[model samples]
Target: MPDLDPPKRSRWTLWLVLLVCAAPVVASYFSFYVLDLRGRAYGDLIQPTRDLPASLALTDLKGAPVAAVSLHGQWLLTYVPDRACDEGCERMLFMQRQLREMLGKDRDRLDKLVLVPDDVNLTPAQIDALTAHGAPATVLRAPRAAIEGWLMAAPGHRMGEHLFLVDPMGRWMLRTPATPEPSAVKKDLERLMRANAGWDKPGR
Candidate 1:
């Protein structure tokens, strides 16, 4: 009959070629996720790099569309609050601004984002107040459900209870505690900028 022996050396060579082609990708994944190499992070990893859902949209104070994509390429310090601006919301806003300022020169590398969940209507005087207290933050009005997709509650906590951190690539990276101490949060921000120095800079 025809050769009953296997393809022998040719089959072995083909298997070797396939393994060689996949080596780099496999090694990178191992080094990054499995092996926990030196540069690997201890921080929580958000898979798939969540983006602003397409169904979500925002409007500026002037009633113009504010594209969610505008947030890309800058480190974002985000807060979710209502237009009514209660005492708790006001305190959170102050903390967000102060935390950015505490970054020193690195402050320019970050942007403050306030996601208002409804069209509660801000009077011109109220707008003036927000601007006066550095509240002219990149305000965007989105549905409460859409905002919840990214900013989640911790255990019994709620979304508006804490400040969220998003990296330049638009990945939700860190979540500061509800009762965040400014000095402690400042250290965390500085650490992030320092670690990402290779890819990020101190401005837009």
Candidate 2:
């Protein structure tokens, strides 16, 4: 009987093929998650990844239609709530303002955005209150369905309980913990700005 053994050359070829197929994916993860990384990210990464739904559309407070794509190219700090401002909504607004202010010179690269779910209107008084608070937030009227697609409730939580972060590249990159401590969230934002320093600049 002839002795049988796996061919050395075939084993080498199989290993080479596996390495080639995996190299790009490995390199990309390294570049994004490890290489020269600087951000103090607070949100845990979802393994499968979640993103902003493309189908969702929103209108500004003025009724001007805006696409989710409009948020691209800026670090967006977003809050979702009904049009009628409540105490919780007020707190979110305040936190957003504080987070932006904490950025100091890098603040301009960030946008404070509020997405109002449903057709509920913002009364003049409500608008004035937000303005009076010195919060330069852009309030948009979004369909409830669209809003829900992006902002989710934790297992037993509600949408507005947490603040979400979007990167300059338009990815819903982070979700600060529910009722995150402002100081901690500020540090996370600052670290993100620092990490992307080479790419992101202060502007519209």
Instruction: Please list the C-alpha lDDT of all candidates, in the order they appear.
Output: 0.68, 0.71
Give the least accurate 10-residue stretch of model 1, judged by summed lDDT. Answer: 36-45
Q: Model 1: per-residue lDDT, tens digit, 63-138?
A: 6887777777788898876446667777887888888888878888898887778745555664565566643567
- Candidate 2 lDDT score at position 122: 61
Candidate 1 collision pairs: none
Q: Kindly give the stretch of ten consecutive residues in candidate 2 with the minimal lDDT sum.
A: 36-45
Residue by residue across 1-204, what tens digits does model 2's lDDT show? 664356966888899999986675456444555653325356544333456666677777677888877777787898876446677767887788888988988988998877788766566776776556654677777788777776675676666777888766566757777777898788777666666666566755
Question: For every model shown, what is its TM-score relative to the native structure?
Answer: 0.70, 0.74
Misplaced by over 4 Å in model 1 are 1-49, 119-126, 132-136
- Displacement of the residue 149 alpha carbon in candidate 2, Å: 1.4
Off by over 4 Å in 2: 1-32, 35-40, 46-49, 82-84, 119-121, 131-135
Clashes of each: 0, 0
Please list all clashing residue pairs in model 2, or write none if there are none.
none
